[model samples]
Target: MNGGTDLLGVVSSLLGPGGGSAVDPVEAAARVAWSALVEPGDAVGGLLVQGLGAERSFALVRAAVDDGPELLVESCRDAGLPGAESPSVLTGAVAEALARWGPRLGRVDVLAALDAARAVGARLLVPGAAGWPRAVDDLGPHAPIVLWTRTGRRADGPAVAVVGSRANTVAGAEATAEITSVAADRGCTVVSGGAYGIDATAHRVAVAAGTPTLAVLAGGIDQLYPAGNFELLRNVARQGALLAESPPGTRPTRWRFLARNRLIAALGAATVVVEAGARSGALNTAHHAAQLGRSVFAVPGAFSSSASVGCHRLVAEGRAQIVVHPEDPVDTVLGRSRHATPGRGRSSSSGTPVLAGREDPEVLRVLDALGRRALGEQELAARSGMSFAEVADALALAELQGLVVHGVGGWTRA
Candidate 1:
């Protein structure tokens, strides 16, 4: 801690104007090292950092470089850190960690990471920082050691995590938009994984609603992954906040994506999955939320849908409650009364526009599938990912109100 003066100097210079928690310069500098040295979900690293202060933890790693686990384990045991009670077990773990960390030791350049953050006007946040979201502390040993944030604004309200598949359907998109709209109306911050499909839709709606939206990234704050969402994420960084566990130049690996989901789940008071396929990553987020004892909501999708499979499974297993009403989940989580149910009528004064049949999931799915130029039942069924029987029922209802017209080519918009 005392010898990191050069690191402290660089950190002082690179610290930007973003809203941040007040942390000790030495502690913050050591965290920068940990963030740069380890992978996103390094449980060993997290445990060590939490057991020993960042300064001591970093020093332990440095000391163990030659002195070995003898020094590291003794230090942790002396600190009364759990797991150190068994010296043999802790020694083996520490030795493995030290070996993995040795190669990266020489490369830990605190200045480079800070410079990259400074270049993007990002700020560093460590646990106990003033701006740190306390909800994430629920992660316990899995908590992030450091969070690199751009815009650095701290949202002052409850947050809801909206997550879904990257390959989303119209119904899924509609459901996400509706949920996001209601969340924003409740003055809740919307948290998302800054990916495509449902994640993108939720962010767009939250942004349009002028609500504080947080986008957690798997990569560095300097490089927003999923190139398609760069602008949208930039908008979020400009207006609300963008956070990452990695330092400034880290590329998002698959492991990191899964790791960042925990951050998303922890940040929100509740996590809602609008749509997810059998293998959707959003389910991982829901799992993380559930583990943290956060409320989880799943919007029902067509039984024929491949997208909602994960959500359906979650509901069936009672891991998550079904979202009968978008606002119902939000209401329950925030412990407030629901707004008057969204009828198939005009937009409310709250400025939440209601789409016809927005209350009817299948009807919304069918309507969204109809598009500018539509086809017959067969195509509609395929396009909407609905069974022909479901499409027929929806089309029949829509045609009764001139919502569609059957032509020689097929069914087109009326």
Candidate 2:
């Protein structure tokens, strides 16, 4: 093993100066190592990083590999790993994680990965870095240790993930464009996987609209996957960013794509499916979003269209809210604003920007009217004894408060 590798020196030379980087050099190097050492979204690995920090965890892995996991239990405790409640459970989990990680310790060269990354002008980002987006932290123990990105330190705004099948129809493409256009129009960063159909459409629209976008790759940012989107990925990197969890020289595998879904889901406030077949991989992203408690929406197509089968399944199973209105995705991303552009508040002294969801009478009234089902403004106004404009504004305000969610058909309690 290259345990003697001068991590600080290697990273300092390879990454150079990053304009007062908040990340520790050794921590950065260790993250680059972990990105290759473990598979994507490894909860045990995430926990190790969370508890021991990247640099220390990397050392722990190296030690366990050379020796055995038996001696590392005390080290884990000394390192302050927030293991399971029971001591035996903690010991068992550490043993299992070490067993899985032991094989890769000697194979991956952290310094080489960093050198290759810098060779391609890719920037390395570790947790707590200035440009790092905290949203992915929502995944908790499943979060990534490092992100290799080309531009934009963090997404840092409203983002909605638009994804669907590679074999998309013209209609599906059109719908995807509309969603992306409206989202970008409202100043939301459209996040996607940079795949062929719907993902490409979303990126193209975001780029064309001159809005920030993020394309999260399953492989490496050094080589854009799907050879066709090379230029498009470049445009995305230029306007916003091209990011990946896998290190340089890594290929996209089926399991990696599945792991990538959780990242796409975590990066956005919502996930939108334009079109998909019964087994479309986009469904995987949607399911991940649902698990993370992020809103999910699916655009309905013709009942007879096979491409829409998975979308229909989402609606039928009550997993996703239907995108009945064109503004739904925009609302999902930018929080249902009717007049204001996404940035800054038009608030006076008493604007009620952040409701606690129950105290405000207007919010409570809207929630009571919403009850169990989604309703349009007119129906809510009539039911809640409020005027149409009042209901509209209240719903808009409540959407931001997370007290209610507008699913296009109407509004419902969150």
Candidate 3:
């Protein structure tokens, strides 16, 4: 076979036979090539892949090696890929990007990366893959070319990220574990960077609770960082997923970590900051979550605590809602039970009642049956002694009234 056919075969073999809903192997290989060709969050790479298909874009980049990157820019403009940005601005941006990307061109070996991923039992998930999260689409031009994932199964529920300072206080650690336990027990997948303090606490608690947990890494799937959290990350991989945009053996850099924050924020339905100092990386994730229109919650620490300035600022600026207890209504919005906390009413901020405390008896029955755990429509119907249609009707009304929420895991009380 020729080199082109040989490359395609190697790519296709990684996905294996009967890999349902996996992307075309050739296109997937091109994406892996792009991931290595440019740094994370490379806008130029994003535009090329977005405007032209990945295969065509890869061909253009390869052609540019001899023809000059300027030709690629002109081709993009000719293809009507340049939107709104003035030609002069686009010209300079493309020029600067070319300087950065050109040197890396020779280093891209799609087949080697694909082989590395296969060796590690990882799969390349492109945009249309069966279990790709729809939330990251919010990044637009900044979305990852592909995600390298090692997962046991696709989580049935949406995740909630718990992020905070690496130098977190004891209170912050306790808070992370508490909130994670509640969220996981209610069938929410827990997501976090595999870092120390709060991120580690969140992953550990979620794994212990038998809930799916995803650790979005700054490096490659093969090179887990922070070495101290190796065991925890391994458990996370077994129970949930280890996701990265980088190929195998890539080292974590400062810029890569910053770029990695976007994925964590985009993956979660909501992000909760347990404790963060001023200018913390957790704040970066919170900003990304806010930009994606996802809920941001801050756990308030003592006013005297230096580790909480970011959280306080977020709350005061109205960028985040204050979450003092596990049962706060924010969890409900993500389809976790708002009544999950053992002593919810003990705190005065039980939040306003849904429908002014005069809910329909059928809706109330479903909510009671839901408790803190997720229940599918049929299970809810069985437990509530209501028909499937009645349960559906009740769930819809309750969700509309803010009394309950329904997500991939089914339904839960609000």
Top candidate, metric TM-score: 1
Q: Extract clashing residue pairs from model 2.
A: 375-410, 375-411
lDDT for each residue of candidate 1 in 1-414, tens digit (9 for 90 to 100): 453667676675554333232557777888888988887656668788887888889888988887777877888889877667777656766776777689998899887888888888887777666567777887776788888887735688878899998999998899999889999998999999999999999999998999989999989988787999989998898768999889887888765777798899888877898888765778768766765667778885888898887777777766678888889667865762243232111111212111233456886788788767535567788889999889977765454333454432346665
Ten contiguous residues with the weakest lDDT in model 1: 345-354
lDDT of each: 0.76, 0.75, 0.75
* Residue 68, model 1: Cα distance from true site in angstroms: 1.5
lDDT tens readout by residue for model 2, 70-172: 5566766776666544567567666656766778877878878877888888877777665676889988877888888898434567788899988888999
TM-score of 3: 0.77
Model 3 — which ten-residue stretch has the worst lDDT?
341-350
Clashes of each: 1, 2, 0
For candidate 3, write residues 115-230 as lDDT tens digits.
Answer: 78888888777777666777788788788988888888578686788999898998898888888888877778888999998999999998889999999999998877889998
Top candidate by lDDT: 1
Error of 1 at 126 (Å): 1.5
**Which regions of candidate 1 are displaced past 4 Å?**
1-6, 13-21, 336-414
